[model samples]
Target: MSPRQRDRVRSLVADSEAPIDAQTVAAELSVHVTTARFHLNNLVEEGSAIAINLPPIGVGRPRVGYRLVVAPPVDDLMLMLVARLGETPEQREELAAEVGRAWAAKHLPSVAIDAELVPDPVVLAETILTRLGFRITDVVSAFGQHEITLCGCPLEKIEHELPEVARGVVRGLLETALTAGSPALAAQYAVAVRPAPGGKCELRLNLAQVADSTAR
Candidate 1:
């Protein structure tokens, strides 16, 4: 279907530990079962997630569920920091950059991975986040804009590390997705990262003028 829909499915599948049936996904997203199924099929086809068929219970037909198959572990620090970024848009980039620097300064001290081996900044950030267990929940596109939301990752541990490079990576990913024309509109873009009550982090994009102003 739409890019936004695919993003949403990615988010949902990433968040789930086990296979999730269409009914559950529909309920969480407030969409019709058929709509959920359509998106799930798309995700499966894209190789972003996997679909599992359940054994029949007794009465009717068996149900199917989808789960994220290619995601990495969830990082507690990244989750918390991303969530906090949502509260203030005026300084999101600055804040994200600062967070990234802080992370490098602190955690990088003991990390032994070669710099060259690290994926490109954006992919590395996404990989670290997925490893930290963040899930994609929604990809919204309206009025010529694109935005994505992620949930199910703890944000408390790494709030201090979010700054500079980390923020840049997040912003870059949003730009990349938008440049790819994930959204049908041609407008300014904004990315919001926040955490929910259940240790779930929400990353959203706003295509409204507010987004345009912030981008400038």
Candidate 2:
């Protein structure tokens, strides 16, 4: 989420007469429901809002609603620095991704790959996440899909303020590691970031459609 996007979400929450649900936010902002929910959850984590169980109107479960609250004091130095990086939001995001790539490249191991010692992308991703101060709480895999749930991001502040960059860091880390050890796996799967509550996120490795001979 960019600062602009977050501000819009905040404004929506602030202006609503009643607590707003993520569906309403998504409709108002013209964003995906998941995107709206991610920001809403982030706001709750930041103490800018509170989640309440709304009275059930008609159905199976009560909708979760978000209500505005007094936000805690925030440090703006990092945001100020990010503003100076680029003239536009897209430029800043790209620059941030480059920084992520550089950071990953610097810290990742440089062991030469051998035919008998191919590195597993999931294992390498976990190692990188650990180095970045993330705690892996759950990992599930079946068939070709793999999911890693991480808690306690060291870049929580950055994630709240500039989520694109935070996502870029995750992407760059896995990408660098995958390309280094197993380009085949790199071509076979792509990693994605799924935001969750309490400064946590899910890293999903979705298998990409490729030729049978390519992934080998």
Most accurate candidate by TM-score: 2
| Global local distance difference test of model 2 | 0.74
lDDT of candidates 1 onward, in order: 0.54, 0.74
Please give, for residues 125-155, the per-residue lDDT of candidate 2 as tens digits.
7877787777788777777667777763566
Model 1, stretches more than 4 Å misplaced?
Answer: 71-216
Q: Where does model 2 exceed 4 Å of error?
A: 1-75, 84-91, 197-216
Q: In terms of TM-score, how similar is model 1 to the real structure?
A: 0.31
lDDT of 1 by residue, 34-144 (tens): 988988987788787788888666888888988877655467545654657756544665666555444433322233444234223233334444544556565555664
TM-score of 2: 0.54
